[model samples]
Target: MTPPAPNIDPLTTPLERERVLAAYQRACAALEAAQQPNGAWAGEVVWNPMLICQYVICSHIVGREIPEPRKQRIRLSLELQRKRDGGWGMHPDVPPAPGDHDHHPNHDRDPAGLAGAHDSWMFHTVLGYVALRLLGADPNEPLLQDVRAWIHAHGGPYGVPTWGRAWLALLGLYPWSELQPLLPELWLLGDDSPMHPRRLYCHMRLIYLGLSYLYGARTQADASPLVEAIRGELYPEGWDVSRFRATRDQIASTDLYEPIGQSLEWLFAGARALSRAIPAVVRRRALARAWEHIEFEFASTNWVCLSPVNGMLFCLAMWSRDRRDPRLAQALQGLEYWMWEDDSEGLRICGARSDIWDTSFALQALCEGPQIDEAARAVDRASAWLPRAQLRADILGGREHYRESARGGWGFANEHHPWPVSDCTAEALEALLHAEHRGWDHAAARLDLSDKLAAVEFVLLRQNDDGGFGSYEPRRGSMLLARFNPAEMYGNCMLEYSYTECTASCVRGLAVALEALGANMPSELRARVQAGVDAGVQFLLGSQASNGAWPGFWGVNYTYGTFFSVAGLLAAGLDGEHVAVRRAVRHLISAQRDDGGWGERYEGVLESRERPLDADQPSRIVQTAWALLTLQQAAPERGREAIERGLRFLLDQQQPDGTWPHDAAVGVFFNTAVLDYRLYKLVFPTWALSRWLSR
Candidate 1:
């Protein structure tokens, strides 16, 4: 049976206790109200306007017309994300500084006035201008005029980065010959070859799989007046392909996160020369091999591919081969799974769906809160939905296709989305364990013992030799492979290295399952779980920095990493007196803002270190919740005052309707794109407060 909820803290004043309970009630209500009809609590996975731009460009390449209504909505979305400098940025506008309530007002004003914001990538600006034009916006319109001037001032379209160049070249607005090559012949490399595409990270390799195929075919849309007009507009100076081709290596300063190094340049030159030397017969064979992989990817994910970025690329590749292929239509329809439409952002395709990820976390939060009885029906629905969302079988011929086994795991989005991630599986297993331990009424919906063991085995398989876990697969390529990284807009994307968050989640999940399974577990599985937990703990201990913070690869910064690390350690049976736990507690204590909350800037992600946000900067609800959750587990007695203050901050920040503000980006990836998960504000804080009350 589940343990009883802890008594209300004796030290809390009567008035404070009343406030806490009221706030808790409201937050629970808000969460319950937000549940979707399918029993999931999916938030919009907000990203940049680049997705909209790509969608428009892709529709043009495939000869699909955008309906007038959808086009207007896309235009509105572009207008909303435009910066004060009359350019589109790589991510949404950063929230304003403290005491600036109207910073992001509900009007045309650019709140941050961040004209030169780091997020103002030249690639996004170029895509935005072209997308607006394709959507039928007048060139002489004031917004278009301002955007055009911004483009010219930023060195025009020639300065766009490698991927941007590829997109433009595909649309016949730029020259393909001058762009850096993505050789499909690389796919012909043996499985054992170190440089094989299969050795790269799953997302990176899948994207290039489509890109290499298109590059080999020299795929370009048929020339149209729209393409010609956009071409002239992009290069206002002139459309001299040879003159602009010289600037192929010249990326805009704003968009260069990882410069193409000297070694990569040599490799590119060699690849260009090799492309010319390869026999025509060999080239045809390589393209056929590349197409085999593309077809396998489409079959694996039911034609969704991996992400919208690659999803678009694969659609273009399919059209180039055989426009009448029925699978091309299926692949195009699968892209709709990632789309999110709303009055505010209009019709935008998300980078990925968060249904399973969001629902798993939300379930755990509800189970932890004192109001579980009120949320019982919601819990029952979510609990029932989670098991259905689990990937029940491995992808057939997964090894041949370079896929890790997905059986007993959950993908980030939903079951049909076949790329199951380590952290997502761990978190989902932990949530189910919480529900089962509570003896929830949905008995028939519960996963069987075999299912639970399969999940544990799945996570166990993801553990690297170093004892840490990677996101999708074990580390396949060397860190030295990073030198060959071609995606300038991203970082650490060439290989799947072990991440602190993934390791911590796996540790905690395995620990909980070990206890929950009790005598029903097999002895062999138990031994493996114990060994995995011990090694994972050692990895966490070894990875902690001198200041006791761990770098967060998935979330905003150190606060996220430290929170998961501390929780994992405690769950692995470490006490508050453990040196790692104490150091982590102290780190959180030092980072606490004067207002009693916590905040971290996205810039810290770029620095690959924990640079605490300035004290005067606005604190974030999600970070504050993370801090409170960590402090309560790791230093409840030593950091009592800090805990109480954090609780108060959360309580005060709660709105009359029960939710806290999503003040900043909480999720991050590739050290660049910052993500705003909309449900984060409601989920984390409610979890924190519930734990505080229970404690």
Candidate 2:
């Protein structure tokens, strides 16, 4: 039977709520300044609370201490996030929206509106409390008491999620056996074997690598006297190591969003039973093979490792491997990449980095910005350097990455990290298109980036039987790996799910790229684009639910998906009377709030065969921009007012410096819950104003 979750205390002193609000506001202002031309901040650029935290962290990084007003704002934000029990959520805009599918009863909505209800997730719990703690609440406060109690009840040190366990293992807090095997051994499987971790999504593979190494060595952390004491406090009963690993099937109900199927569960049971009998000689051979892949991962990422979960584990693994290992030492250099500081709280780890990813769009958004000359020198620098970032060759043992064809391109930062993300490339291209059209003084001289569009040629080759594209590359793996998904901090983030925004980005980018190539796009490539556009249009049309929204895979939620997807479809010619366009426009219109803007919950990004979680903010700057863009695409008939209202919302939210207050996350794609998108406010709003006042 599942255990009861920690009950977030319902009672709150009004004074406490006000304190949180002050911190939250201060954080928002600091993050607003971090935008690099485009909308993204720096790392894990996602929607909702991720964005909220960016503002908070940025506030602390710049402010001597969080200003009093800012601390109060942040504190209030956290206080309201307190559910009936002691746990916290990723966002305040989540939770309790009945009509919103994100809050649907059937799905594992946090009724409180959190996704990782996944109580097994120590990362969120630790970080969630850390956020509140930073906001000035006492760590020993009752709210944290419930959280600490919850973590302990779940198995405390032993009971954390695999990802969280990996982190604790890094700190030498938990032994690896309490975890299942993620050894490099899986990488030895036949190419066709779907079970291989190497074949898993990049984010998952990186995270698993860290888990595998630490688990392989059976490392255990040294417990402090307080930790030993708290262990008793967390679990009423003493910790039993053997019993913890035996409950492999044990999962919190909230975390069972995707339960392991009987087929896999039975298969795993059989594998475990067989491993016991494997000859020591054979086991030695397996370990050797596993080490080869481990070395490869280390080499590929320059030891920065993949994402944070894996990065953290890799940090521990390297440290254990050797105290002074260069890679391990370097790996620790970017710890701040994931950690955010706020006045209310000092610092906490964040999900991932946004360095190159955000800049790709930021550059483009700057291209589309009203003050195109604001960053003219920076634009020239970016334009000249962009062509240099393209992928002209494959990486070491590259194809095993299942990279498929290496066409089109990605601009999440530039070509060095080019993994061929469809939307990142498409969005980058659109931004470039904007710049090219703007005819900057150097536009003609620097027009050479045009030839680099050959990457789009690669994208045309990866289109699916359905005519849509997946992020990073073609969708080649199965959903079966989702069951092995070890990240309790997020669900199904280990594999590619069909994304409307990603597909749309590819569509629009391809169209723009083809136009730029002029006659260079061969008949074969043009035919592919034609097929992609036609199929994409149908898929999008078919995708519009009765409620009229398309959920996003890479960003905040539905409003995001609807805008990017509809923009792609209409741009590809499905506008005017197209039934799909009309329905989508109808949905956006229906959602338009009295404020003359639209808002959605980040929860809308989730798709439960059971239900969905909606992002719960009204009139977000990003959503409003997306809605305005869609209206222009599908309903120019609505005139400028539709666009006008959205622009006004963006303008209204804009700080005196011309940046908008972040209201939601503006990123989404294959993996990683996001943060950053500092430029979403600037770029999208700028685009909206330009479009509304079109010549």
lDDT by residue (474-525, candidate 1, tens digit) is 9998788999888888898999988999999999999999988988989999
Candidate 2, residues 252-365: lDDT per residue as tens digits?
443333455676567656666665665766655665565555566556656544444555555555555565565554565534344455553323444544455555555554
TM-score of each: 0.96, 0.76
**lDDT (C-alpha) at residue 586 in model 1:** 90
Go through the candidates in order and give the clash count of each.
Answer: 0, 85
TM-score of candidate 2 to 2 decimals: 0.76
What are the lDDT figures for the candidates, one per model? 0.84, 0.54
| CA error at residue 459 for candidate 1, angstroms | 0.2
lDDT of 2 at 356: 51
- Best-matching candidate per lDDT: 1
Worst 10 residues of 1 by lDDT: 95-104
lDDT of 1 at 346: 80
Worst 10 residues of 2 by lDDT: 1-10
